[model samples]
Target: MTGTIKIDNAPLNKFHLKITAFTFGSNFSDGYALGIIGMALTLIGPQMELGTVWQGLIGSSALIGLFVGSLLLGWLGDRIGRQKVYLLDFLLIAVASFLQFFVDGPLALFILRLLIGFGIGADYAIGPTLLSEFVPKKYRGSLLASLTVMWTVGYVVAYFVGILLEKAGPDSWRWMLASGAIPAVIVLLLRIGTPESPRWLISKGRIEEARQIVKRFIGPNVDISDLIADGQSEQHSTSFMMLFKKKHRTRTAFGCLFYFCQVLPYFAIYTFLPLIFKAMGVKDDILGNILLNIFLLIGAILSLWFINKLSRRTFTIGSFLTLTVSLLLLGIWPHGPFILVMLFFAVFTLVMSGFSNIAQVYPAELFPTEIRGSGVGLTNGVSRIGSAIGTFLLPISLASLGLGPSMIGLAVVLLIGAVISIAWAPETKDLSLDEASQTPESSSQDVVSSSPRKKMSSH
Candidate 1:
């Protein structure tokens, strides 16, 4: 069970931060590419002479790709390894982005956009899982929480790019879309120097290689003597079905349900923000979209500050509550003053940011290393189903119900999310990935079984 130990003076926190930063950078690039498509769709649609239905179809093409990719590639990451799949995904994304430059008609653009979505969907599942596996227990939550920071950076970059591209004229949108290829190139290059997950290696019985990778981070001198688990001698391989085994089924279901609820309302609100603003009498679509991105940036920044300060469960619940109230207000008074509309948008951004920050970290902590990737991927894949439904149905709902009723419907969904989160999600603020994976049922049994059995002697 024991392995070679290393010791060093550098803080473990510093190493974790570096690893997180690298992963974050890669994700930032992927997210920027994805965000731009959503932001620029309005401008690109009409200039290309697309009708309402066609516009919706073009915009949703990427999401359709994402929905499929998340399930297939996410499962692959779990079955093979995170690093290998991640590197391959970056390459695919680069190719997709490069091809986007050549899109001339609706069918061509739709296909290219769908490929880009596939890359994004794969990255979404693998990136966070890689980052979470590499960090130490003490800083895991905050370190993993930082993925949202990268996501925001991408969104901000897209926001400015959208504004600039709008003025860049008709041909300029092509360049703006293709510009996303640059980051993919960078990530592909940078990831070549990165190591595979040490824990994954160890679980797969490649102890020496795992030790070498761990040594790179913890320094050559630090003692991992106490960190290695006795169970390393035992096999730890897992399959997708293992997630639903007797001991793990409830945990897997909980994780999947939480992710589903998290995305249901969040995507519903986000995908329709511009439309909602227009309904509220904001005639300028570009301006409305830009403002939405700004509010999203503000929310992302505030989330970084509060995510580590509060309990994961508390912050998540509070965020849902905040979103619920904002949606309620917006629903009740769709034609309110500009200031009130802006207020709701701002609050919506803030709460959604908080929810997103916490939500990404939660799944990474929910399963053992053996099944962590599968568990996260499965949950995320299921969540994408909800997102697909939201993306497809929200505009239709808005069309029929008006902005007010649409907001109210989303508010009710968020309320349901808040209730489910409070009931089933466990607190995992400071626990290590492995410790958090240990089921509550097992822990309770340990407590009960260890109690003294001296009743006969007393009688």
Candidate 2:
């Protein structure tokens, strides 16, 4: 009976699927909320008489709100609990989404979308952190990678929904924005009784509670003994400052930088796909966007397999380099033949989808249970800053720099991401949670199988 349970190699079970379903829904809601606005804006801009500045504000506001939500609530999730915050944030998203249907002005709509973004941000911090802790290492990479696919599906679905809703009438923009409530509400119900992470429980020294939950939900023989031993050092501060401390600073930098680089161009390009298409001289912007997004969705689906097949470092670095090349082609030949333009856009979206998939898995794996939420949140928050900036400035850039130069700028961003990946991306494939979270210097020790070291608590 002693030390018999080892979650690192445990087989997939029903509980794992349940957790994945709940987390998947959250990412789906996020993608829908963020993507719907791009199309809605085409209608809202003229109907509401919004200029580029207001449109940019309205477009980027949710991303700005994400920055606030992740930095604050992500830290709070660590102190409180994941399930509590998970349900709370969904309530916020659902309420904000429904409120959008009643907005009379651009300012009101902006505020509502920002609130939705805030809720989505909180979920971003919690969902992967929660799911990653519960999933066995055997399926962890693919399971977590699947979230990005859900997100892409949600984003593509938003476009399809937007196309249909646009035919509903002048007020259709209101309904389009509010449609985000549907997914949020559904996920909220799905998460109603989800359990807290046993790792979080163990980190907080509720060892008996952790053991009982793991036994009941996971299995009686699944061992959390090492987790219990690790809990003894639970005095590590969950403060944001701790992320910048010597032990975690490298990971913190890589997580934030890589995420920021990937999303800056992603939000910038995809959020205005129609506009980019028109600028590129595409005759039917709407149809072109749909096909391009389909390619994006395909890339996300493909990454689920690639994540396990290639080392994380190799996949990430290669994805970025490929993405950079795709964008550079479009940049250098802004008015390329119709087929070439479509091909470049398709390549960029496809590569970007796989590159962005890392965002779901890498940040959560960077920190221990005590601050996993915070670590994920901090990276998410920083990345949103990049997203917000790119979203807000894209229109302005297009107006001044023209589409060709703007494409070049985005290509440069991807090139920077490739360099950063080469410099710092860690290979986390096949590693257990304990091994993945540790710095390279200390990861040689298989702490999960080793005898507990004797130590006195600071407390």
Candidate 3:
């Protein structure tokens, strides 16, 4: 048999599990921030006397900040170190949360949300990179995908908190919004003093540090000479432009397209689900959030099981197609009865849950250690623009064009995403990150050289 793949084929350990949870806490905070904001807006809108336009701005302010954070932090992480940027972002998140409790006006709250989004954006870039770098290839997909589970759990927790505090008088919204700080603080604590990624260290030419990381956490007796060789071959400096280089161009396009396709509709619908529930005749906001999250969580769990079984390309395309169908049904009858609306939303959430989980996993798989942060960060940042635009305009669309047209538009976006996924997304299942991130030309050469027939002749 061919010798085992050294770099990515290492065995896993407890430290890996611990760090994975710590990293996952970032996604939990992200989910909480987005989830709590929706309910808080319903309450805060009237208290602050905000209009539709201002509500939309408040809704999208963090996303706008996220756009900047993802790009800037991703670049920074690669230049400095993942550990440094990752920890600092959570601090920003904590400070932003505390400041939000003091908001007396729309502008103050919006600016605070924008600052929170900045930190979240950086987490988006740095967190996944840290996770992917530490985990062995065998467990990487599921472990990385578990962030979706954390996100769903966080969302549910926030909803629970919102419901519990709903009867706490007019200031309940403050409690809901400010509560996000707790999780961020916990994440900061959990990740404190954790080592930087070994893969990243190798990419930076710190072979000794990388070796210690591999030996201590990755697996004992796992050789990494090939990994170091590959890291040495890659471009060392960090920049978004690195993604556009010939080797990474195709993968970059795939990652961005994958993110934008789902997030555009995902944010537009899920971020404003509370409002959408009202439009659909769901009288109890608390009940609606709990019920909707149940199916959403179920879908996320299903995706965890299915991710390893299904091809990334096929699952993504099918999810978009399914989402398109659900949106089409909603567009056909936007004001349908409660049962009909619930059915459509259930389908939409299920599809969205699967897609979102896979989207994060793919980005970590597509880029090499050197540019992984920048690659995922840039695409994530770019897709945040899509999310922001979609969310900012959804309210306007609902008011002017009616919910029918908005659903139709989301359907169109899904269809486009499906087409792109079918055309470009590479198969990443069963491959280690290094193996998966290799350029097509390099992979082909490795395939030819590792042919069984060549090995047989040598023997």
Question: Which prediction has more favorable TM-score, 1 or 2?
Answer: 2
What tens digits encode model 3's per-residue C-alpha lDDT throughout 387-446?
Answer: 888889888888787788888999999999988777777766677687667655443333
Residue-level lDDT tens digits of model 1 in 1-459: 234332212256566766676677544764575567666666677778876566556656666676666667777877677888777777877888888888888899888878877877777777778777776666677777778768777867876786677677777778778888888888778777667777677677677787787777666654544335633656665777888777777667767776777777666566555666677897775666667677777777677668778866688788878888988898898888887887787788767865777757888877877777777777777776777667667777777778888888878877877876666666666555665676645543332222122212222
lDDT per model, in order? 0.71, 0.85, 0.82
Model 3 misplacement above 4 A: 1-5, 233-237, 284-286, 441-459
> After superposition, which runs of candidate 2 have C-alpha atoms over 4 Å from their true positions?
1-3, 440-459
Q: If scored against the real structure, what TM-score would every candidate get?
A: 0.88, 0.95, 0.93
Q: Which one wins by lDDT: 1 or 3?
A: 3
Alpha-carbon deviation at 364 in model 2, angstroms: 1.1
Candidate 2 backbone collisions, by pair: 5-222, 5-223
Better of 1 and 3 by TM-score: 3
Of 2 and 3, the candidate ranking higher by lDDT: 2
Q: Identify the runs in model 1 with alpha carbons over 4 angstroms from their true place.
A: 1-10, 13-15, 222-234, 284-291, 442-459
